[model samples]
Target: MAGKSGRTIANVPEKSLKKTLFCWEGMLVVLFILINVFCASISQSYQFENVLREMPKYLTEMFLLFPMAFILVLGEIDISVGATVCLSATMTCMASNKGLPFAAVILTALLVGTICGLVNGLILTNFQELPPMIVTLGTQIVFRGIAEIALGSGGSISLTNADGFRMIAGKVGIIPYVFFIVILMAVLFSVVLAKTTFGRSVYAIGSNRLAAYYSGIHVQTIRLIIYTVMGFMAGLAALFLTSVLYGANTTTGNGFEMDAIAMAVFGGISTSGGKGRLLGGIISGFTIICLRIGLGQINMNPQLILIILGILLILAVLLPNLSARLNVKKKA
Candidate 1:
């Protein structure tokens, strides 16, 4: 039997039960360990204690990776996510400054993000004619514009009561609370994508949307739910980012969407969709985060790091295509 992606499904239980350590994911695991070793060797300060201390800032981005994996799986993208994070974070800070309770502040952030996502969903589902990229592009501008307006003259806002944020940012035995949340979310989202019927539908849609719709998969509804989920994750990311910075501004989440997408692509999840896994993206996210930390310790230029990442992204997409073409040539 074959799945909608045209990939064959295992027919035998034994075949399904077999595990291999030679796959791309296994290679990624090895690379991850090797990278850590390299960082340790190059920087004596790359020790565990210091890593834990610096990890929270990067973990803020991990919150977006899970849902982004799902979005990529659906053969779609949401550039507005970074802007959504800015808007949500802006509101979160504003709420805190207004003397709202901590719980209320959190809700405001999440609610604003969800509503932004809902707007995207409603427009896309209702219209059915707009490309996701274009729609999100417009929203991206709108979201950031709204945030900029809110921020006003200084274009920034700081928390009046950081006690609440400090509580969330607190560490337990050297590990930040955000790290735990990332792990929990990673596991949950990975399972949902890998083991559930809803996950199957997402793959089916990405592989061939027409087929999935004809098969009664409720394509519009699924897309809406996924986009909304994306917004919610952005909101969650904003919450953690605020805890770390104790402030939010118009530029608070600039380029975060690119970072999340790069992590997903580098981890082996194909932007073309209907392929790859979340586990790889999760591992890749950490790899990139650790690399950035190590490089920063060495005082590398930020632009140079971005250039390297851009090169890596290109190679990731290119090498796969080259390999596939070679395989076909050999078969012929």
Candidate 2:
């Protein structure tokens, strides 16, 4: 009757069914609504069309959130994702500037990202004793260094042919294409995590790696897949980002890894792993995006906005632990 993550399988369906309807996600919904109201009140331009216009840039980060949730659920992290995005975007811009077909340019970005991810996976799997953070941190520096070298003294590249990128960034009515893609990806990732055997395996490994392996789960394989997926998504993010920026620079994805992690953590996904859901992450992602857009409209200093987000991140991490401790004390 016990499940892979050491929870009771009998109650899983009931819990899953009500998961979005109650608890953390419900509070997030309320918070999201309040944020919109507050933002609208503070800025006259916080209208629907204006928000959507600002969204495509921010939505690029959401692409990272899905696979990041997967990695976090596996009790692992990838700080190199921002570098991966930078590298991918650099390659994409270079390819486009060289007069390559738009299709080839797109492929270059995705391929670079996948290769970076594969390298990370190979290193981590081959050197089992190496911590993921350390390994990814090393790769992060190397990847960004490569990007900087590629850009040389200029440290940036503009897309000579932006027609393709512009098309993808196009909006239908008030919403951009990236918004739809994010929603589609959100559904796909959410379903896989919530309903599939693979999802359960991730939780099992996070909950107890040795037990999951003993239970017949391919722990290393799962980790490899998740990391590679992380890279692929980073590439996808870079592609969209190119659409928005029409170029690539050494700093293209600076702090993007932190932003993705913060969004995931805020969405109720635990860094320690074995718990949380993508739905919560999705909701929290939007909440933060809306909050940021609102703050910007009111002419808040950029540094101040970052500080506010940092404070929220701290609260997000702390509140759960505090609540859990309170529950334990009450039980005693």
Candidate 3:
């Protein structure tokens, strides 16, 4: 009787888990299809070839989305990512202009981003009491400020040697190189989060930090690692972004943090953490990209497009919480 009861109880939660994941992901898939259809209907230029060509620029944010999802799942936030991108791009352009080897120029961007991320991690982990938001917010300003000073009076730096960036920006038969890279990264990050011990530890920490620490998880170490990874990805974003713009400026990556958060939330990742999947985030990221491209094709005002995204983000956050509350009431 005891063995039978244990098996029945385990099956119940497993079934419930499957149902919940299916419902959310299913809804996202339906929504994704609808979005693409709508986009295609409204714009002739929304065809596959044009969409693929435009995707590389937008896909840069997906790189940030992966790490940002991890950070969000850790129940923390980092707003300094945009600034890190700006600084990294600035340094990358500067290094290239100085006639350094292409490899060294790439390293410079990644190195700067990693150092910025390390600084955020050190301050947050060591302080223990400081909120991640406030710490990252400060770093955001500091990073952008440094980039501004480096940029001098013009506030921009164009790449003198565009050959390398041009090569990277090349397409592979109507598909951008960055597209494949994004897909590869998506698979890697999804596997890590869904299949690894470290991934489970992240969930445990997000669910309850004190309990996770008591259970032997090195919570602070993991936090440090994630933050550093966030910085590294921001550097990578800068690299590809430079490939697109062929230059760097103060406003480079200005609104990236918000866009990343919006994509994650729209994909059903809880900002409160301990819930959600990277798969949802990837779908939502592409959904938003397609929507934005469609809107741009219609020659919509940029600010108006931002407003529309803001509204969608609010609905995404609110709808989930409302559904949870209603579910609780019904159970009562």
lDDT of each candidate versus the true structure: 0.89, 0.93, 0.91
- Residue-pair clashes per prediction, in order, are 0, 0, 0
Error of 2 at 288 (Å): 0.8
Q: lDDT per residue, candidate 3, 224-251, as tens digits?
A: 9999999999999999999999999999
Question: What's the TM-score of each model vs. the native?
Answer: 0.93, 0.94, 0.94
Question: Candidate 3, after superposition: displacement of residue 55 in Å?
Answer: 0.9
lDDT of 1 at 38: 84
lDDT of 1: 0.89
Off by over 4 Å in 2: 1-22
lDDT of 3 at 52: 89
Q: Pick by lDDT: which candidate is best?
A: 2
Evaluated at residue 40, the lDDT of candidate 2 is: 97
